[model samples]
Target: MTNILTRPGLKPARPFFSSGPCAKPPGWSADKLAVDSLGRSHRSKIGKQRLNYCIDLMRDALSLPDTHRIGIVPGSDTGAYEMAMWTMLGARPVTALAWESFGEGWVTDAVKQLRIDPVVMRADYGRLPDLGAVDWSHDVLFTWNGTTSGVRVPNGDWIAPDRAGLSFADATSAVFAYDLPWDRIDVATFSWQKVLGGEGAHGVLILGPRAVERLESYTPAWPLPKVFRLVSKGKLAEGVFLGETINTPSMLAVEDAIWSLEWARSLGQGGLIARSDANAAALDRIVEQRDWLGHLAPDPASRSRTSVCLTVAGADEALIKRMAALLEAEGAAYDIAGYRDAPPGLRIWCGATVDTGDIEALGPWLDWAYAQAKHAN
Candidate 1:
């Protein structure tokens, strides 16, 4: 146990740990980014080449199959997901599974905005709904990992191998951290800012052959926004998947993503997953040794390897706020407070970019901050 009155002797070299726009890769520097694409039209030869290269890099990183088409969309994960929902949903019965904030947002979109009246299945934070009870006849929407609650589906085994409906996964935090079963997923969305720690404002949407068929065959009851349109003359817009974006994208952000993606390619998908697993394990070891600290998601099989949420003993919103503030003030951690919608505690980013040594160093600081906050209260 650490003394409440004494500070930890050692500090993390890089203390960045936000769930979104997470810590950059080791040895990353802004000067290393390829700036040749900056200040150039996204449609220009070099710009298009860079964008296409980014897509290719991501495809290789994920081992995504040729059956899926990847495109760089306008908004981050939210935009890419909404585009999928607006365009491909309502073709059949729909089922929406929500266990966290972002998942609930998709439910709202389906029931309220799209007015699809999807069969809603929900669970409390740190828990997952009954996957076995899902109806495969209905199109299924789910988050691969619950970023806010730190819960995740154990694997794609729950998805029916032969199903009438499509599967949509909001996989922003799970992409690089897990080995996703591409054969089971019909559609997926993610942003560069999550595991890769690239700049935001751009999203990547992946559509399987079934999703593309839905786009070409079935038209939605509602009007598609110009930015959301994936079809031209009832044909899938092939150019969009080939580096032709639906709208203008920040070339600088694109370059930044390229740098991160290149770094990811160097490590390979298994390497990225290994890094995240190691960081999460390091945090888990700290939690095991501490009586006051515990994981929000109790099930180890379903617990998230990234965006790990914790439960502090006898903690309240105020105590958590104070503790987080104290750690931030000490330069020991940053942006580690749990999500506002979630229960009060700590949420640490253990993604591929974060070093396990930093997570190990965070343990003592957490004890110090918790003790200080408790004494103050």
Candidate 2:
């Protein structure tokens, strides 16, 4: 056991481990970002060029198929997802799956706001509901990875290839960290802040051919605000997918995303996934060695590689807070506490942008903080 009186001799070089707006790519600095698009209208020729370039780079990095269309939207992942729910649902029987706080939010939207009367499936944190039980005839909404719960579907094998209804995935934290089967997904939404470690308030919405067909053919009973409108005068808005945004976007944020996307392009999808896997493996080694620390998600196959959650022995809200504060004050880690809505524990970001060395170094500091908090209590 680590002694409470002895502080760890080593510290992580970069202590940022927040789940959202996660640690920036290694060696990132504001001076490195391009500023040519700043102080200019997003509708200008150069603005559209930069925006389109960003989309192209993302597509290249993810190897997204040409059969799908990608667009930049005003709201973060939430905005993009809500846009999908408001427009594409209700045309068919709907099913909403919830395993964590964000997933629950989607259920609320489907049930209360949209009043779609979706067949709801739910599981407690750290476990996934039965994928086999899902109805293929109903439009299904689910998160590819549960950010707060640290649980994820193992693969896309469960989705029906010939299903009549569309599949909407909230992939905010899963994209770029895992290999996503694009054919299984019809509509996907994410924010640059998660896996890419870029700015927030901007969202990326991807639409497969089926999703586009629904947008053009089906009309919802609810009134859509201009930002959520993807169709105009009975035709798909080609401009939105091509670089013309529904609303004004933050050019600085777009530039920041482009910088990260360029970094991702250099690494390639395999390299990015490798970095995330290595970081998660390093963290796993630390957890395996300590009997007091156990994964919140026990099953290895369904565990999240990006946002990994752990349960501390005899931990409660106060103890977890004390440990987090001690670590932060010692410059060992920041924002390592569990999500507010989750069970008391520690949530670490092991995404592609985080260095494996930092995660390896975090072990001793976590021991020191845990010991200190226990001794104090």
Candidate 3:
């Protein structure tokens, strides 16, 4: 067992692995800000430049086509998703697919908020929505990766070739880490603080041709908040994607996001994906070595490369709590506990920011923590 000093008034021994607002960019320094934009209006030329740079780098990293409009909107991923739901959903029948919290949020908004007649397809926390049962003839809403459950859609093969309705995807956790079939996705939204390790105040909205067409033609039934209004002057506000916010944004957050995007560009998209996959594979190796533990996601092929969730088999709630507490006390890990709504499991964010060395160190720490809990029992 690793000699981890339990609670000894010391800091955490290794990196944390919670899902969102995950670990800061590796070696990121707060003092790097040369000109702070705290007091400046977001409409200023400098502010717009920063905003546009972030969008451009994001597009380059994601390889988004020039035809698609990218918008930096409010409310993180949730805001972008709600805006899309309210703006373009009334024209067609909506189908919502949910297997985790984020997806559930979209479903709730579709059914209650927008009052859309939705075909709800759902699954337990550890499973995925039945993709086969989905009718793509209607506008479909789904999350590419279920962050809480560590499950993801393996590919876009399930999407229909001749489907008329748009496919709205909440790809918050799947953006850079997983391969997104851009051709099939319409209004795909993600946040900066996810896989790319950026600040978490803005949502990145990518509107494909079909989604933009819907936005141009349909008028929402509800009142549009000034900030959520993307179609201003009867045209899609094209500048919003480049950095213009419908309302003012945190310039500091915007700068940090730009910095993160620059970092991603240096690493290249393939490198970013490789980094995430390697980190996840390292965690899988640890899981393979342990017989008492297993992945929370049933199928190996459906596992998430970003959010690595695993359960302690035969380990009850009390034991799991003890193990988690001991690990935190030892300063080996923190926030490794699974989501409350999810099955008892440790959810680790093995995104681009997390190093494989940290994950390797966590393996023995888990064994030690488990042993300590079993011995105490």
Candidate 4:
């Protein structure tokens, strides 16, 4: 794919707002990626140190506990989830709560691939699974933020106190933007692409004490792939989360992710999260003032701070398409179209990189484009 921002004399119509593989940090320079790692082996001392540095910084920036272990693995968030499932899922029956695409994928894996009997709890897009309805006695798996749907679990209070089962969270899009209840989550996974605005293709796995106990106690029902093998035969893989990746990683991507994390650390983690919340607030204000738009997530408390999904009321399909096209044509925004599986509307990435001023500007732009779309239709 061509660099969407590189068109001659045609500047970005507006700041880019795609969810994954987001726009690069404005201050990022190519010089940082040109280091001499292209020729070195990943297992070498320097490579190990580089990976260690990345994980250490990540742990610190996210305020993960010292007892928690982090693993840098090959597949983007998906791989990390699979690895966790394979290693830690058989201690009890699975309870998979799904409200969006990524959560559905996890349910599929649990039932089909692992051949494990999982009690599936599902909610339509733009809503959350009934956390109260779930039986927390079983090993629980769910997403903290439903990126495609713009919905999220409001808090971790639904988790039972002194619950016997472990909690596995696919927090790919929620990590930095939301206050994750680390005590409630046992295994958490995230990718660099979401809040940090880094390149993709790597997954970070954070494991708590309960998660480690699961790995050390039970074996998976199926055979493990080299990539998915965390507890092999009987031993826990200690270094995998530290610096020993399952396979080769894009050093360039690692470096870029490190840069983004450093940027987040410098900005202060609380400030970075506040910035995303402020951006979402800006978008919410737009939704409130205009009768033409409404948020897909009905509960204001459950709405996402990262991915903000909106739908136009009293607008035909042609109008939505035309409005999206108009924004793209003017370089006002890209990748704002709603997911194909979802009701037609708009989905904006309102994460840390997105400026509140830019989000505020979108209200007027939407008004302009909607009018044009209505006229054309």
List model 1 lDDT by residue over 214-309, tens digit each: 999999999999999999999999999999999999988888888888889999999999999999999999999999999999999999999999
For candidate 3, lDDT tens digit of each residue in 1-377?
44444422333334677688887767677787535565777888787877787788888889888777888889899898888888888888989998888889888898888898799999887788778888988999998888888999888988886888999988899988876778888889999888877778788789998888887788888998887787877788877776778877888888888777777888888988999999999999999998877888888778889998898876777787888897777667877888777887788899987878888878877877877777788
Per-candidate Cα lDDT values, in order, are 0.95, 0.95, 0.82, 0.83
**1-377 per-residue lDDT for model 2 (tens digits):** 77889998889999999999899999799999999889999999999999999999989989999999999998899999999999899899998999999999999998889998999999999999999999999999999999999999999988999999999999999999999999999999999999999999999999999999999899999999889999989888999998899999999999999999999999999999999999999999999999999999999999999999999999999999999999999999999999999999999999999999999999999999999999899
Question: What alpha-carbon RMSD in Å does predicted model 3 have with respect to the real structure?
Answer: 2.5
The regions of model 4 sitting more than 4 angstroms off are: 1-14, 32-34, 315-318
TM-score between candidate 2 and the true structure: 0.99
Candidate 1, pairs of clashing residues: none
Candidates 3 and 4, the one with greater lDDT: 4
- Give the number of colliding residue pairs in candidate 3: 3
Per-prediction CA RMSD (Å): 0.7, 0.7, 2.5, 4.3
Query: Cα deviation of 86 in candidate 3 (Å)?
Result: 1.1
Residue pairs with backbone atoms closer than 3 Å in model 3 (clashes): 13-331, 70-241, 71-241
lDDT of 2 at 200: 95
Flag regions of model 1 displaced more than 4 Å: none
Candidate 3's TM-score: 0.93
